[model samples]
Target chain A: MNLLEIDTKKYIPKILEAVIETWGEEYRYILVEKANKIKNINYIDERGILHYHRFLENCIQKYLSLKFLEEIGVDTSQDDKNLGLPLDSNTKEQMNQYFGNRCIFSPDFWKDAKGIFAFDKEVIEDFRKTSVEEGQIEFLNPLRGNSEITISNYEQFKQTKEYSKLLKQIHHYLDIYKKLDHEMKKYNKKIQKYSDYVDSEDKRKERILDLKRCELYQEIESELPESLRKYLDLKYQTLEQKLRFLFPELDEKSYIEFFSKKDEDNLETETCNVYALRLCYLRRVGIHNNLNIYDNSKEKYEECLKQPGTQEFIPSFELVDKITRTREKKYEEGIKEFIFTSQTFLENFGQMDNLEETKEYVYNLILNRTKVANIPLADEKNNYPAIFFPIRPSYNGILDLAYIHEFIHALLYFSLYDNRWGSGFDICDDDPALLNPYRLNKRKYERLNETITDIYAVKVKNILHKKGIYLFEPKELVNEDNSAWNNTSLIVRKMLNPFLEKFHHEVILSLVTANYSILLDKVGSENFEELNDCINKVDYLIDCGLNLENPEHKPELIIEYKKEMSRLEKIYHNMDNRIQVVTEAHK
Target chain B: MDIRRIIFIKKSPFRMEYLFLLQLNGNENMIRFTGLESRTDKESINSKVVNDTIVTNFLEHFFRIVSNWNDTYINKNTLDATTWNIVIEYKNGKQKEYQGVDSYPINFDSLERLIDKTIKEIGGD
Candidate 1:
């Protein structure tokens, strides 16, 4: 037999019988009596058909309510009135106790009944053909939009024209409600004031009539068209139900407040794109909080809404300002601390000497037997590959540091050529190939290279100081350039501190020689990729900070940078923890 | 004749300096000069004993190259190129040395390949 072709109307009585049996024999008599009353109604005329359908719907609702109460251990046999009444606090508490965290009222319970009892399109069309009123078929089927909107369907639904039209219609109805509410308040105020002053009954009655005749009173008393009114009511009811489900803690008063304010503040100004994105954000918040939307209070929902990314439906100028100020302060303090520490290292272990001697000393220390010409160009700007120093008559600590920095770059460049241990290692400007060898994109490579060079310069200074060859006092290097250099290097150093602690020189050598597989082998591929991501983020943040004066410094860049930094910190923390665990195991 | 020690050094202005020293002191004692030190001020040089098979294989190839090579090969026109020096010391206090600048004998490529292979086999790469 074809199930779809089966006449569902024939099974209604049998299904009702089964439902009544599940509620126990004590309530079976009452439910049967109600079903008989609904069946006995004359469903011939248009009005009678509507009446019959409503009665049957009410009967089913009562049966479901009683079944729920029975399952929750509520005594529904004593009174029939208890069937459809709202579950009180005591009943709700009992239900919670029985169900624990499990969802007791999900739509899945109705799945089989929905399949068996639902009238197919052909049956509904047949009914319409035979029915005296088309409206009667609507009562049986309701409207299409009454279906629930879930996270899965939300993205597709929001793209439909129906969604946009519905939002606009909702906004229009809300505007009407707002105006009517204002006028009603005025009417009530006039009635109250008149009653306070008027002593005579006839005079008081006359004044009330006069107020009723006024425009405000008439407007307050005016009714919406029945069809429009019904549509709005259905939409509003669905929205309220969804709100309650999403935020279970929301009470009636708070939902009313949220609904009204949402209409006024958001829908009034929101475009379709903004509204869709906001819904996406809300869905994310729902998933993150993991609250049973049916059980939570309004306060919990509000708190979830206030979480960092979803605090506002859209990014506001105020949020951008707050993030900027916080980042600026953090970077300022961070750079200062880094500069101080590097300078302290220099002071404790570094030697003071002239630039000429320091140049020779740093080159010999880093390059050893490989000697390249150490040229101090007359130009003030430095270049790479061929190490160029800005020749100044009186060299300060900053100049000496810059010379060391550039010289390291030159050394690393020369050392990496044809010196890699493995085949298929080639230097290229393309990002994919660069990333293949080192797990670093071009930007990451450049940033890491700069940071490594700066750190090596500081280390070289310390080595020189140990050799009793001091170049300049730490005070001379106390400038912006020094702080900037230290800031970047310090971030990278801190990120790689665990590996550096184990293989300090090897780490530097691997980076310099572009033998990154050595490091990748030590730290697994996952950690290597994470390190690459961290370097990329740091590079992006630095670039954004440098371009703060440029018009391209957008709020999105700052937000992205902030998010990346937090993620990088999390990954680094995980890596550190894993390494510690391994180390401890070895011990 | 039993070889007591072997020393190899290669330097270039545009490349990393390579230095290797091996001493047969009852074991194949291999020492590598890294040309860079740790932050803790540890010596840049590291020494370890490689297996006899690796040393024997390396020397078997090394001796063949030395037999065909001259005492010195120099390309005076190429002033700023690589310079390589190799010295073999025997147990009897006699030494054989070979030096080159920007030039090498016909078997030089094979010798370089053998050295590279031996370095990796000994975990120097």
Candidate 2:
């Protein structure tokens, strides 16, 4: 098949038209209305500021303006610099006087219309030289109304369901917008390749038309509602404004160029993830919480961080964004609850031997990637017993299927043997040592423990489907081998005779957990009767098994048990083969 | 009442820099930060003052220390000055040892004074 040789520019407008159409007319109207609202707000606010010049004219503000003016000694009329950001002269002067001999350059500062200032390039260079901190400008007072005090109307407005729902919708659209932006960047390079080409006049016309139609940014904008559009712009501006003032000489072009110089332009590569993206782009990754590890075991994770985006691809991200707790006077004591609950969980349930060590560990809390991402994935690292949760972090359903079945195996491991031992056998292993011997120790109530877990996992799938989360359930199995046939074949399979006899005896001693159809009301009769008989009949066999513990080296209970377990192994092997024959015939 | 800034320095082994921060208490509640990776090849500077000039003296002195140390560590190869950057964290009133660099604008003394002034101006918190 021949690939189309058409330039990428040609497909731009058509895709954009389809995009705008999907968003519907409401989106376009929202933008237009928002533009008008912004125009009106700026005009009204400007008039209000002019009218409110009385406040800044007062002695205190006037004193600041005067002192600041005197310190800088730069008149407003002077425009020697083509592009110098407004600076805060007083702060610069104080810093300069303090660190004079060690100064990198003369501190220059300017404030914009909102009274936010940027230091001179020289001042910033000095700042960088002295310290590597993202220089902050904490206002002694609030710019808007007191951020601490709640506004009555605004407080009430937030309580409305519509407001809450809109916030959720805004987040959803933001997700879509991020995906679109990431995908469109790939096409930009392809379109630029034809810049020096000797294209015909018709081709040039087509290319220009394509460029107009393909405006990716506009389509993303149209998807947002009026209020949300304004909100996003406000947030974008807040970050941009803060960075510009903080860095002083960071013009948008220079900022973009700085990122462009990087191999992956990782500094400028914005991701849909707000916390990760903002921290990464603005050179404040540490502020998002340290995700670095110092352990030898986690060395693989360290190498991945150096590459552009290894963390995002790796399924289990070891993130550290757990909530913090505070002794506060607010509604939900903030991170305070998070801190307390995590600490409490660590103290009460954690597998810690020393109190001091546990406390220290609890203090340095980190969030699991799956939890932080709010992916349906539950963490099983601590090996904590848990009920079935429907989904996991990624959409990949394989682990969910595998683990869901394994968890039931976990229940058996816990019940049959003590849990003080490390984990059970890896169920995926092909070794016959584990599989051959599993049948002899089975309780008559439910001999096929592994199969039982599978059956329950299927039941869980059905239960979840009722809640709208669909999971594939395997069909019910019907073993064709009858008890009489097993009795007759037991003599023929002489090599597995001892193992088979042991299994049959155990089964006879064990009471059944389930009846032929269903045993909903006979729980006591079915489960207890079977278990009691097994204990009653396997008295000497259990003694021999338990004695294996102390024979040579109190060779751990599991190691000792393995020797005796091989007897049952032969019996289980015969059963597997016979059952396999029956199941194969049905298939 | 005082406000102090902390910067965590991972010396020697990993040599990766991280800043574990916290506010320090005044009057002798010192958080002993032991177990820093390395203790070799370090130069220490110490100073004290009574008057307000202490701020200027502290900054100037630390700047000199860093300048001297930067030359010693990065440029000079005769001696191993791998521990180039020095943290000037304020703990209690007393600076640690010759190892502690006097850099930050407000040490315990100045920070306490600043706090007192602020309290008095705020009408006694």
Candidate 3:
């Protein structure tokens, strides 16, 4: 095939037209309007195409940066640098002093804008050096407030006269929150004390509950101060008022419903999450929280230091969904399936001891990978359960195949972790006998497991294909012609392939939980080879059962095979006992 | 510049594998870690003294990269399945271990390139 080359410059306007069509006429208008407003710009570079690309990048960066800043009352129209995206060393130093290393805008927001949005190279390098010299910057995403808090409102707060009143109000609310927090802790402790007194597990729970129903609890509740009760009532009322004021589109009932669902969804341990969630609510209403107020208010500066992301609101759900849908769509389905399959495999084949926590960890690990670009493909040494393939054209064809394959590897890794004896790594280092098994357990490392993975991948495809859910093109199995099949057949034909038999597969799966090195150490590889030879001879004799030429030889081979089976069973018995001892000792 | 030992083990899902352990304590020594191929039912472990400039230069750059690595991004999810565990034991009994898992320590790709180049130069592959 002959490849045709085209000039990139010729397609620039066409590409722009397509982008404008998809993004809408409004976006194009904004780009042109913003570009015209800028002063002293050189358009011609070495190539006009390069200049056009840079021009587009600059226009998008400036427009998005300015628009986002306007949301926080930065008034980019007055001071463009007020957004704190320093493109030069001079601007960066000024920003450092103003924001103290905290970016005025959230990284997520910039990430959304895209296209050369980060600080210039020199500025970034300077910041890196400073960070290394001092300590890492605690990057905070500046939170915005409701629509009422505009540029004028921020200016009023900065003047110190009007700010004092707002500071007092914030302190009053914080004091009530702290008191309520303490009371909740005290009540929980008292309930725990009462529950511990009863001997019977059932009676302990009943007595505690019954106690709560009695007048003693009422007396304790009544002992609370009237002022504190009034304050608590007022706090909830104020929060509801704030929510209604911010989201004016919603009525009182709708606000209540929103808060109920949102609060239930975010019952987090970290205090910062609450602050960020509240800030998120306020920011959506077009207000700037002006985090500098925390430092300037002089009332709760110390307290504010404890909670991070004071300046930053959590990324909006819409933004998060947009990212996942666009950039992460390639591997998202496969990843979700991979996680589901891994959990299913572990539950069915794993040791099932302390698997609940392990399952949660594995799920979170895979979920976190989906959020970031640096998805770990493989870590056999560290025994990570799953890996993600990079998004490349060469790998696209085999991604589904590899996903299931890696999921099986993860199952194998976790099954070893679930073992009572110890995790695979633990046994490798701690067990004296198992120390050499890493070198000896050559079958897994030798790509035999890969061949098995290939079989399992096909099996998974077949299962999905039956449900009309084809993940990938299923490999055609021509047993006579395939190398994978030939490799699998050799292993199966040589050693009485346990996987072929249901009960034997169960036993083999169980054995995987035990230390492979220890199992091999006890059974002795010599015995395995001998067993392999014996199984082959027995299989040959069975094949000869129908051979009229070897009628007498079949019985003789059967007798010899039975003796070899007895020897194999004895070896397995010894190995199992030793494994049980190790399991018990670890337990 | 006092290097102790370097062990490189390449494992695959297939049967063929290799283990190369190089020691540079006073007298340089190299060990070929082979599997259970010995006649007496034991793994054959042999040690030799071999001087190779490529290995020495590779070690220098490996340590340099490790020392300058920004490990702030090291997290539970940022792990690679295939990893190289480099443990460099010094003369002062201080051991510095670096693991390259999915280009972790951020400079693993460069280190891999260096090692690959050295292997090719020395005809070790």
- Superposing all C-alpha atoms, what RMSD in Å does each candidate have to the true structure? 41.9, 34.0, 31.0
Q: Pick out the ten consecutive residues of candidate 3 chain A with the lowest summed lDDT.
A: A38-47
Measured with C-alpha atoms, the lDDT of residue A394 in candidate 1 is 16
What's the residue-level lDDT of A570 in candidate 2? 43
Model 1 Cα lDDT, one tens digit per residue, A1-587 = 11112222243354344433333355455444433322110001111122222222223334444455564356755533432223344555543432332223331122111211123234344444323122222222222435355444655765889767654543453344334335444534433422332234324333432332232212321232233234345544654343333222211111112222333354333212223223333453343445432222334445656777544333344432332233334333332233223322234213223254443433332222111222222232322123222221112223335444544443344222222111111232333544423222232354555555555566664445444543322321222233423324354555555545655544644644456677665555586576666666756565344233453667666676557668767776666676677788889
Off by over 4 Å in 1: A1-386, A390-397, A413-432, A435-444, A462-468, A472-481, A484-499, A502-506, A509-514, A546-558, A574-587, B1-125
- Cα error of candidate 1 at position A97, Å: 83
Model 3 residue runs over 4 Å out of place are A1-387, A391-404, A407-496, A502-587, B10-56, B67-83, B89-104, B123-125
Error of 2 at B74 (Å): 38
Which tens-of-lDDT digit does each residue in A1-587 have in candidate 3?
00011121232233334324432465565433322221110111111122222222233333334443344344344433321111334444434432344333321121211111122233345455444222211211122123334433444544665455544543453344334335444533433322232223224333332332232223332332343234335554653343233222110111111223333353332122233334333333333345421122223333443456432323334433332232223223333333444322344224222345544544444333221111121222222222332221112123234344444333333323422212222221233343222222211222333334445544553454345542332222111112222123342243344422323333233333433544355445554445444444443444334223454665675566567667667755554665577678889
Query: What would you estimate as the lDDT of candidate 3?
Result: 0.35
lDDT of 1 at A435: 45
DockQ, computed on Cα atoms, for candidate 3: 0.02
Candidate 3 or 1, higher DockQ: 3
* TM-score, candidate 2, first chain: 0.18
Candidate 1 chain A weakest ten by summed lDDT: A39-48
i-RMS for every candidate: 33.9, 29.6, 20.5
Cα lDDT tens digits for candidate 2, A132-177? 1112121101322344323334445457785466445434533442
